[model samples]
Target chain A: MSSSSNGNGTPILELSDVHTYYGSIHALKGISIEVHDGEIVTLLGANGAGKSTTLRSINGLNRPRQGKISFQGRDITTVAAHEIVKRGIAQSPEGRRLFPRMSVIENLEMGAFQRSDRSEIRGDMDRVFELFPRLHERRNQKAGTMSGGEQQMCAIGRALMARPKLLLLDEPSLGLAPIFVERIFDIIKQINDQGTSILLVEQNALMALDAADRGYVLETGRIVLADKAAALKTNEQVRKTYLGET
Target chain B: MAADASVPTLANRLQRPSVVGLLGVVVVGGAAALLLKNLTVAPSRFFEVTLIGLTTGCVYALVALGYTLVYGILELINFAHGDVFMLGGMFTITYSTHFFGLHHGQGPATILIVFATLVLAMLSCGLINATIEFIAYRPLRGAPRLAPLITAIGVSFIIQDIGLAWKGPNYITAPDVFPHSRVFSFHGVDYGWNKLIVVVITIPVLLGLLWLVQQTRQGKAMRATAQDKDAAAIMGINVNRTISFTFLIAGALAGAAGLCYSLYVTTVRFDQGFQLGLIAFTAAVLGGIGNLPGAVLGAVLIGLIQTWNEGLPWHMPGSDWTQSIVFSILILILVFRPEGLLGERTPEGG
Candidate 1:
């Protein structure tokens, strides 16, 4: 695996030699990565490849058994998950775990749970609405009743409400139709363009690499390959297994 | 599908203002007439019954808050909350009697002592309940729903057995801390100062809790955690801590209510918690399990119903059947309006 820095500057989020466990089962094995500011970084893997474990570890949903996770120059390896949010890291977890009981607008408001300033929260909400007009239209509807694409919009919108410096998105296109998947990726790029760095995890390596600036291929619980997304897309090994190329 | 589609329409009709208004008029008018007729037989007896009902109802509401708060976060019935309430009363009694040596007619000093003692007792109970959750409930959180439920029941029984072993099957009298002074009179009605004291203390605490939940940062965290634990955690909420806080608040409320009940009723036993817990649970279910204001409304309504039921002249059910009637109503409400009077239908799969 390649071990070169982005060369832009110091990373926004740096995980060094991270190890994670779920009860007795080891989930992450010495994972290390650095996500620089304003870059789209994708972690590509099959099921049980520890992609979700990595994302969860960053947010403190699953604490790393061994390693240091630094965000924005602060050591946050042992910080509580909610405190992590207060430090400007927000995650849209797998399955779009929105508050099914809350309306779309309420879900968005919850995204600003740590935010103290109402005006800024409202402004961010408006920006989210602008990004996903469908959410704006169904703002009062319960999130559970929406279509999968619409729920994905709500999930992303909720994450944006945190005004996060780095947004961790786990499986944003997990269950969406192909058209919605494209739309979601386009929106992710737009979010990154607007200056929010993204750490995206996806099973669909092709779309992930297409949108990501750099890519890391995770096998089992280790990073097996790392390269620029364009080069990885054309790599012989990546194509044979992940791209289904002959 | 057709039946499901029409159910909301039917529910909408039942909840309409016109229907409620008509029902209110009939029930209130009939009750007033019945009470008036009964006034000729024994006014003092009627007054005593009314007082008893009011006192019991107030206590029920206090205990109900505990159930509602716990249900709001965990969505699990904390069967042991009532026992915790009972423990609070017992603790208050022990402390006030042994430590302070408090007695009746000591006026404001005794009241203050009892109040402070009760607050401490409540705080301890809250901590204990939180511990119970951490030990027994947290690990089982993602397991099947029934698993936690059965554990809760087991915890309830364990707490009860502990209380029984500690205190024995004895009905202990609370120290007469507050003086038996009639505070005021209104138009031939002598209002006992004790009733005023309970109401005065309880109203402010309830209002304070209501405000805390509705307006604070911690409040938002609680609501978010309740909505979705995983999402809440991702948003940086410490789901475990929030849940513990919920249990703490609920336990404390129950403990305070227990203190109030012991002082007003003048007697408390380990077993009292079971009956009171049932009534509070009924109130929570009546008001809609997870809704806060609904619990308060349900408590007040249940209180008034119990008071009015006992005070009515003709067709008045005796005190023995009060619980039976209350439970029957609870079952009927569940069958008819399961979401409760004020609970909205929560959406699935956020």
Candidate 2:
């Protein structure tokens, strides 16, 4: 991971020791992470390892009881969830929580809810359609009725409509066919190439490590390993536990 | 947008030979027969009754739309909405009688005063409904579904009591300001200016609301929030504010209904909102609770059914059975198809 001292300046998103709880359960315990201006940072973990929880803390859905979070160097530790999106952060949340009754175009329009520039929104819609041609074909289809891969594509496409500076994607390839998985990863890379930083949470370690520039291995609410994606991919413990290597 | 060919469509489901479906067909067919018989026997009386039904349905549609709007966003029945409608009528009565001293036969001046009263009542009720949401609903949002539902019922009683205190036990009457002159006539059945006035105002408001919800940016936000609050928030939509705005719109609709009922019916009591509210609620449910057009359709259908039963000449159940018939339809709907006529049949726990 590129630190501030390495001439990268302040990271676009920085979390310092964020603690989050789900009632009595300590979901995220003093976890700190960073994503620079144009890098894809992936958080890889087993179930209950707080990977999703960390993203939740950063996005303001699950407010951290302890620690500071900043985007573009502005304090947003206690900001409301909707305000987080207004500050150029958007999430294709877990389970692809698309509005079931709404058509695909309607869902995309919803992504630009905070935006005021009416004419520019159409351009963004076209850009999203360009990215996912499958979505374009099914633009009138209800989000819930689509197949899993299509729904995931729609979810990512919906997030992109926000024109976010930092896109928080939770398991973009959780339940997709192999072909869709590859296509999604390629789009993720293309999205990064266009200058939006990303914080990706994924259980698919191999695919996530491949797409990400830097990788963090989270275990039981704390980040255990933080290194370049290449290095983490070759790490002995990561290979064994996460990659399913016997 | 098309469902897979193998998947049974709504038409197919309706045609499927289930007991509920069979019963529905029989009931609908029987009602159709009765309606046809009544129409053939007394064409002019039927048309007059139909006009009256349509006018009453417009009022119920306004109130039913309120119930549907709140229910669409929050999935809460918002029992107090009827009381809000009641208060709207009271507001209209107060403004027309005391503020404007509006009486019959004032010509164009009366029109201006009535219009002003309509605006004031709508604004007042909208603010009140929003306030009710802020106080009663917002705090219990994270609580279980029953918490908010119970609170809504409680709020309904509170609003009713407030109405009771404001107008006393007696019926608050509005001046007979709406002209009784016939707009059009056929076979001695005159469509009066009062009835025409109700239709003229209602159609525009309903259409405007449809445009707002379907076409506008804020409407998109509202729909997104209704579908999924968390996902909507992630997309930069303010869920709470959207919910509050929904209540505001719903309350405004009830207020308009109140004004119409006061002017056309000319008499509104404090507890009337509760009875009317239930009928409207039933209308909303019948049309498919969360669906906008569905509520209006259900309201109109119920209005027609009520009037037809009372006004028709041949083997009619009459006015005394209106409550029983309406409630029975509600019960049957709940038992057979909770999704209602226009609602999508979402699998339970899906």
Candidate 3:
């Protein structure tokens, strides 16, 4: 199934025939996808399905050996990971990837490292606090000292501090408690509503589908399915393989 | 819960004597006895030695700070750090005597000459260190951790060889440019201006560095990078440039220490870096290798111990045992209090 690319404006990010490798292992074999402005696109896959690899390739952490990645209509395939963030794209990354020693506020400040807007940055900090009040309570506490769910909040807040036009979130719900998983999905939908594009990766098919506008099913470095999220939620193969509804 | 209560707490475990406990007792007990024995005689001498120790300790602290800073970011020891310190000293000596024609007791010119040498040495060493990071370490970043470490040692040797060619094997005398006025005199023990000058420069350099690493935006990037390099990049921090900045700051510190040692100790030798560098490295490890303040504390402790052992009126071991004692402290700290005095022992985050 092909997800309808209707009504949405120009593509904010597009990957064409992207193939990425890790040493001898070919992780992403010629996968193509696009995320339009102001839409949520979820990449659905199991472990080792190259979902994270796709995000990594887009962010230039693992540059695609063979293909082009364009963001906002400019080629970013060879850009450095840090430079990619400066180009209106940010990733919260796998495992939260927090600076364990830094406080939550400092972690947020780091997300805005490339930006020099002091008052505006402070305003965003307040906005983040409003979004995740638990972070406000522990703003001075080290990221490592926080609970896993709180650390996950800090991670998302950090990426938001960049004020990116497009945010790549990898496994945002991974290892979170079920309650937190629900809250995270809620925040993802809320964030998408605020005009920022999102490319989300998740193993929680039901929650991802509930929040995303479009979905792609990946297995062993290839996309086997792409469709509207409603279609994916009801698709026979998605239900049997990922939704645990055989 | 009752059964769990029966398990020994850390304090209870210590109460039951083991081989490790006995070793700790022997080491602490021996050190206390030696210190007590020395303090009982010629207390004035002890006071004098302490004043002298603090001055020299400041020098060690400057160099030790370099090691800890680089280690904090990269986890690489930057073994070449000491040679950079050595070259800083060489630069100080050359720029002062050869370039400026500075001599002993030149009044106001002494201050100007010394300041000039400080800036020149610091800037040159900073660039050299940054270059070293760009050339030797960056390429090996993807290799095993040991690769960078080995390359550090190799870079250290190359710098040492350059120093050897610059000034040969002999100890080169540095012209005393600092004023020799006495800061204070009591019971015929006077603290001179020469010692005061070293401390004056060292305190601000250390405090400035602490501020940079703790308070500034750049400092936040550094701490973040140190904690997680990949994560720092994800946050839009230029990790490569941050690493280079760390090296530059560390190199400037080496330059500051170089200038201090040249003026106060009054000599520079090509092979001196290996000896002093090892001592500073010992200081770094004893204070917890990657900790900043711990590095300074450890350096002072080592400096005091060395001075006391050599200068005490009691059964002193003399200056020859200084290296052995300092290195023994390194081994003992590794075996016992490896986290260092001021450092927190963090469990591996992963």
List model 2 lDDT by residue over B6-30, tens digit each.
Answer: 6544555656678878777899999
Better of 1 and 3 by lDDT: 3
Residues A1-246 of candidate 3 have per-residue lDDT tens digits of: 122343276688999999999778999999999899878899999899999999999888898999999999999999998898999998898989888877898889999999977889999999999999999999999787788899899999999999999999999998999999999988887787788889999988888888888889999999999998989898999999988986
Q: How does chain B score by TM in each prediction?
A: 0.87, 0.94, 0.93
TM-score (C-alpha, index-matched) for candidate 1: 0.79
Give the TM-score of each candidate: 0.79, 0.95, 0.95
Which 10 consecutive positions of candidate 3 chain A have the poorest summed lDDT?
A: A1-10
* Residue B312 shift from truth in candidate 3, angstroms: 1.0
DockQ of every model listed? 0.39, 0.60, 0.50
Q: Which scores better on lDDT, 2 or 3?
A: 2
Runs of candidate 2 with Cα error greater than 4 angstroms are A1-7, B1-16, B347-350
TM-score of chain B as predicted in candidate 3 = 0.93
**Candidate 2 Cα deviation (angstroms), residue B168:** 0.5
Proportion of the native interface contacts kept in model 1: 0.68
Best by DockQ: 2
Ranking by TM-score: 3, 2, 1
**lDDT per residue as tens, model 1, B1-350:** 00133445435656767755686578669857777766657676666666656666777888898988888788888888888989888887877887787787676687678777877878888898899899999999878888998998899888888888888889889865555567765435566767766777778878988888877778877887987787898776788999999898888888788778888877988788988898888888888888887887788778767776766565677567779878976886776667777776443111
Better of 1 and 2 by lDDT: 2
The better-scoring model by TM-score among 1 and 2 is: 2
Q: CA lDDT, every prediction?
A: 0.82, 0.89, 0.88
